[model samples]
Target: DGYLATFDLDEYRAVKGGVAKKLYRYTNKRLWKRHRFTIGLRSLAEEKLGFKQGQFESELARSLAAPVAELQRFGIVCVIKQHGRMKQVHIAKKMKRKEAKEPSAPVPSLAKKLLDRGVDNAVELVQRFDAERIRDQIENFDDRTKNGNDVGPGWLRCAVENGYGFRKGFKPSRIVAEEQKVKSEKRRKAVADRAREDAELKTQQAADEEAFAEFLKFRNSLSENRRQELEDEALSKCSEFERNCVVKARRNDEIGMFHQLLWEQYIIPTLAED
Candidate 1:
């Protein structure tokens, strides 16, 4: 099989960094640029040498000579080409085919072939091979009933269940019933999983609402002295100019409305109530 050979300069840098630095000046510059070296390998030499029409092999040979030759020792052949502005290497394994011989025994029928392959159920075997045929028969029966073609409901049901075949010892109706039951179970499990996720989300929302209500109650119950201590703490956290800016920014909407209500309804009333 064809395989890729990648020579990472980082590995060489870690192992023989000093020696590599001394050999070439471009080594350090190229390492800093993060360039990677890769080569393709094939088993067949002729395929590697062969070039397609309108393809140039000489230019590729000039670009990848020493590294390509080095990889050949490991049973690898290389083919390089420029695809657009980027250069690419293709590798392939040398494959050989064996001659064919005529069969000496008689060819078995489809039913006999299935039985010989250890599948003894005739209805199951036929349905597996030609599922589209059964589907077409069912669809045709549905169309006939829709167009008033005198097909009784029982007849359509029997045709669909038995899959349009009355072979001896074939029980397609039972198989169809089992297939429907499996589909129903899969749908039921999916619905149950969705219900479980929705229930968990609802419980989390209720808990968040309760926590917010408790925080509002605690803030409302502070004494006037305690409120003054909070105001002093807030003032100490920032300069007077920053506090004035915050109060000015909140003067347009519900935030300003809340600030007014906090001073009037809670702070002033609490001092009077005390």
Candidate 2:
């Protein structure tokens, strides 16, 4: 943490002087000032959600109940106008720079959305979110652009949500239907592929486990001196890849690479011993 602690006076000055004066001077202080929000809870609620204000004892109070309850659940507001316990809520928000504008967040990354949706299987993943369909929509968008073509239905939503491309028009229902069909096909394919991969992996793991068991039996049958001799022999016979893996595994306590090598077929008994 203190990499600079040993620096000499001249070296310290050389490092300290690296930052240019103009870069520091150009930063705008005025832009950092607090933003003023003029809209209050009463007006903003009514404007955004169509909430209405009326006498607490009147029939209008019934209409206000649900909207006010929803608004106050935001934690930033408390609507108590119903019980004649109405209190004013002042909203203060500063607009941010272009990159910082708080629009509804774009769909999260595939991994994040998958985890959040608890989608582990291909069917679940496809049903919850159609990644392949999104991809096809992107391709369609590209094809249309290349030919100087008009935007298709579902093009606008697809472009804005995923591709960051823009088109202005009402989305077509047919495009959505086409997207659903493509996703359905992809899910079926993905499920089959995943099943095949899992089967291959399990078969390989079973073979490895059987090989490891054989090695362990051989090791366990040996005397203490014989065991040490075998361990040293195994260590000596390690390939560059095996040695590197063992060393790294020992270095990293988080994962036991050395123990893994001792069981793996890669570090089996020597030819003479076998």
Q: Every model's Cα RMSD, please?
A: 25.7, 29.0
lDDT digits (tens) for residues 88-200 of candidate 1: 55533222112222234443353333333222232343555455454444455545646655544234333433455533333345466788999999999999999999999
| Per-candidate local distance difference test | 0.44, 0.43
> Which whole-number lDDT from 0 to 100 does residue 100 have in model 2?
19
- Those runs of model 1 whose alpha carbons end farther than 4 Å from true positions after fitting are 1-171, 223-274
Please report the TM-score between candidate 2 and the true structure: 0.29
Please, what are the lDDT tens digits per residue for candidate 2 over residues 137-255? 44555556566765532232324233443245523345668889999999999999999999999999899788667666765677868755655566677777776776566568433
Per-residue lDDT, model 1, residue 95, is 23
Residue 172 lDDT (model 2): 38
